[model samples]
Target: MELLSLDKLAARMTPGSLIAIPADYSGVSMAATRALVASGVRGLRIICVPTSGIQADVLIGAGCLAELETSAVTLGELGLAPRFTAAAKAGSLTIRDTTCPAVHAALQASEKGIPFIPLRGLIGTDILRQRADWKLAENPFADGADPIVYLPAIKPDVALFHATKADRDGNVWIGRRRELATMAHAAVRSLVTVEEIVDVSLLADETLAAGVLPGLYVEAVAEAPRGAWPLGLQDLYPTDDAELARYAEAARTEAGFRAWLDRFLDGRSAAA
Candidate 1:
């Protein structure tokens, strides 16, 4: 009902839940994710809207993911996402490799409370061939020449992410990154970690109101300073480039990943 601890908020998510996380460049609830990993939460079906990075890789490395639905997973300048790449290569992960628009359209379908959404393109692409769940058909509105791809709605059990701030009432400020709002709208529950929890309502200001995701959509909120660690939280701080580079290197091998995980968990524990 009130602001929860990171671990407590993570505990609200059941094992094997279909969890939707924000894109690579968008803010992710890494602090809450680390808490979940520490608590040994497993069998999660992760949906990385559009793309992913450290969040997906860390979950894969911790053996917490059963499936990953995303367009791509890369560490940007740090190179490929090691654990995700390894898992895909070893055939240890069930991947739904679709295009970015497809993922976004699926979420939009859920947001609209529709069974499916039709999008243009992907007529002869490998993405369409790989995704058996997707279907193709002649466009009803076309003159027998147009084709469309139908993406099934993706209604995640929980939407998890980090925000710049949240009011005491639990509404979060996501700024211009509206995909987080879409995730919250499409999921059954929305859990967020915020850099700051304020007493005043963000909606009182018209400028901030436009970007505020009302508490009605948010199930729980937790105050976690630097909650999006290693990833940038727009206007708050930049990504930890040095640490991301270290993660990319260490997660290259199982042995190296374990060592890195140990140090990471230890550091997290100390911080807690």
Candidate 2:
């Protein structure tokens, strides 16, 4: 079990690495994202589990993303993800547009150590047409009439996220968001940030055991209270609506976005 500083954990990632993050509502490691930005990390291929909001937007604004693979990037009720939308519109980043299920299926295939996973939907759609990597095949079980779509396994170089709690042994309690577990299984390494670290083993109790992501799959853990700021953490805190609104408005233009980034970086430095 390894417990490191947020910047140290971020240092473990290489430039242009394929990194996976949890969905918007899920606990996101915003502290780690800030740390990465502070460290001037660049060329990351960020893979949002299905969709993202502030986390993706911040990285995109910082010029850290070389590519983004996700279904959508929206700030939920806050509105559209400004930096993400701008980047897409400006053609600044490579986007591997995919559907929700297709992203999930790819991660699932990686978790199960499979080369590809067949999905039922996405036939005769623009989503299927855009992805030449996806292959169409005849179902061997049937009379070779039915067709299936196969998605390549999405084995990310790192899976980064935040959790409500972590034990001294490094096990993280993710509760019912089991997609995090699948991400850990699919990624080469899993880096996690938590609000707190408890002394007792999370797996020692039966009830807690069910929700615990075993430390065996985790590479490093960092303590980051209110880490999912600007976004919500389940049962912990609500989204920082005021800050998100400010970000959305400022990020509408490149100049305004740069000003926002300067303010954010200054605040982060001051806090540090």
> Candidate 2 residues 49-126, lDDT tens each?
988888899899899889999999998887888888888888999988899888888999999999999999888999
Candidate 1: how many backbone clashes?
A: 0
List clash counts for every candidate, in order.
0, 0
Clashing pairs in 2: none
lDDT of 1 by residue, 67-149 (tens): 99998999988889999999989999898888888888899999999999999999899989988899997788887688788
Please give the range of 10 consecutive residues that has the lowest summed lDDT in model 1: 263-272
TM-score of each: 0.96, 0.95
Off by over 4 Å in 1: 268-272
Cα deviation at 94, candidate 1, in Å, is 0.7
In order, what is each prediction's RMSD in angstroms?
Answer: 2.0, 2.1
Give residue 81's error in model 2 in angstroms: 1.5
